[model samples]
Target: MPKVDAETIVHSIAAETNTPEETVARIYADALDTYRADARVLDYVPLFAARKVRATLRQNSAKPH
Candidate 1:
């Protein structure tokens, strides 16, 4: 898989979820940090991080607030 940058991941998640860019950036950073902490396979870091972030966004969107 091709390497992905934080900016690209942030923008992508933002676009896909219709979330604000700034919010996405923050979420992306947090997700990356969270995933990177115990990553055994470096190659899939970005992909995994993106998935986690997407899940969080979906959960947030489903909330009443």
Candidate 2:
């Protein structure tokens, strides 16, 4: 797993989802905590949910022709 940094994660999520960094930061906070992988890597469904959010957004953005 990639090490999660507040700035890096926020930037990445924003870039990937075309969302604001602040929103991603909030999502991170609601999803995890100080350091996303700080100590709860295998005890929650947040990580999956975050990825799902991004994936869904990406899918929605992709036009079907």
Candidate 3:
């Protein structure tokens, strides 16, 4: 796959999860070190999209639908 650095991953994840940019930056670095991997993929970036999406949907649903 394509090479992905911590910074790129950070911005993407932050936008997707609505997390703090700085925290996302740190989390990206930590995840890289935690997994000891060389490259990251969009399919698995930050690995928290599903939960975030779920939470968002729940909140939206709580209002109406």
TM-scores of all models?
Answer: 0.87, 0.50, 0.48
What lDDT tens digits, residue by residue, belong to model 3 across residues 14-53?
Answer: 6776677886565455554554455454446444433443
Report the alpha-carbon TM-score of model 2 versus the true structure: 0.50
| Model 3 clashing residue pairs (backbone) | none
Which residue runs of candidate 3 sit more than 4 Å off their true CA positions?
A: 37-65
lDDT digits (tens) for residues 1-65 of candidate 2: 65445577668878878888887777666655443556555544455646755765577669686
Give the candidate number with the greatest lDDT.
Answer: 1
In terms of TM-score, which candidate is strongest?
A: 1
Stretches off by above 4 angstroms in model 2 are 1-3, 33-65
Candidate 1: give the clashing pairs: none
lDDT of 1 by residue, 1-65 (tens): 77688888888889999999899888888887888899887888888888988999999999998
lDDT rank order: 1, 2, 3
Provide the overall lDDT of each model, using Cα atoms, as 2-decimal numbers.
0.87, 0.65, 0.55
Q: Could you give the candidate ranking by TM-score, starting with the highest? A: 1, 2, 3
Model 3, C-alpha of 36: deviation from truth (Å): 0.8
How far is 43's C-alpha from truth in model 2 (Å)?
A: 9.5
